[model samples]
Target: MRYGTLDWVPALDRPDLLAAPVTEALASWAQAAPDAVRQVLVAEIDPDQADTADMTATYDLPLEASANCVLVAGKRTGEERIAAAVVRATTRADVNSAVKKLLDVRKASFLPMDRAVADSQMEYGGITPIGLPAGYRVLLDTRTSAGPAIIGSGIRGSKILLPGEVLAELPGAEIVAGLATEIAA
Candidate 1:
């Protein structure tokens, strides 16, 4: 697959490009998912340019073609709740309202970076929804799951390319409308 100036290769052939959990998830998925749906593409990138702005500019990828996954948490009745919200780079997750309501919490906030990284076992700024912990809700903003887009590879050194339909079908993915709001230009 070709995305902008990058040549994307099958993810299965480049396990080093994926985080441990993502590789494990892909392995399990291969046994049950259709061959066509198993097509995940990846491209190498400079880790220093992994941030959205730098990535888009440096790699010649359009901003809209990228998605970001963020971790949010809240508490209700003394029980902790967590969710992963995937949204387009051009927008921001509506964690204060949509996510809080979905999680049935009175208030929601971003999970601390330390906790998010430790719990997901993914790099900060590179956490993708592909292999989130099973217990956490995976919320897919409508725009993001509809891919043919770029996303984190669970590592800063690479990016994953996949279709939206595939993302919507990810394990535990809950496709939600208005999960994200576009940012002002």
Candidate 2:
């Protein structure tokens, strides 16, 4: 199915009808990034989604990548604010060291599945940085903003393509550098 300039199976308008979980996610993303057109692609089970998939191998490709970050409003141990950082597949978000310091939180952790889904209003595998609450902080990796990149659309089965700048316009979105780095294989 094609919506706008991008082409993929299981259109975003009918995510409930799609059979693949990832496809549904991608469809939702397409709707979110209507301007990105033709940059997003829906593939089979991404290696990143597989527990056994090699991180090094997965990072080497040009796939739609989104990073999960925990944000806190204060410098307390129990305060946990979860946010998603979308970036290119080649890079990983600097959650523990950099993002943690930026949010001024005592600690930052990767959002667990249940909490991520609930907080972002996205399916387990389909959380994007867009369509989040206005107050929730969404930090975009520099690489993602440099060009057109694929990102999640609050679902798990699909991805959408759009210029990274558009993602910054989403509510509570901020652009930051050093959010991601390539892990040496």
Candidate 3:
């Protein structure tokens, strides 16, 4: 398989390309949802271009086909809540409104980069929803639920491409209609 002109292989067959947790997650997902998991494909990339804008341009990919997995957190009654919000690159997560409300917190903000990386055990620019901590909610934007999408592979040297609908089936994922606001692209 291929996406953006890059060769892709079954993520389950190439554990070396995935972060450790991602490898485990994919294995479990594959067993439970083989049909969806079978469609997931991974491709190697230059770590330097792993960031979205750089990768999209360098690989000649459509922005609409790219997705970003943003980590956010807030506290409610002294209990901390974390969520991984996945939205299209053409839009931005509605962190201040939808997310704050969903979390039932007074405020929500991007999880600090250092902690996001350390806690998730994923590289800073490659934190993916596939392997997040069990406690973290996975909120997937409605607009990204039925098309092709390019997302992080839990490592800076590769990416995952799969149909958007599959994300909705990920463990603990919820499809939220107003989760993101469109941005000028």
Rank list by lDDT: 3, 1, 2
Stretches > 4 Å off in candidate 2: 1-61, 64-79
Give candidate 3 regions above 4 Å deviation.
Answer: none
Tell me how many clashing residue pairs each candidate has.
2, 14, 0
Query: Comparing candidate 1 with candidate 3, which one achieves the higher TM-score?
Result: 3
Residue 183 C-alpha lDDT in model 3: 96
What pairs collide in candidate 3? none
Better of 2 and 3 by lDDT: 3
Ranking by TM-score: 3, 1, 2
Candidate 2 residue 51 Cα shift, in angstroms, is: 9.6
Error at 126, model 1, angstroms = 1.0
Q: Estimate the TM-score for candidate 1.
A: 0.96
Which candidate number has the best TM-score?
3
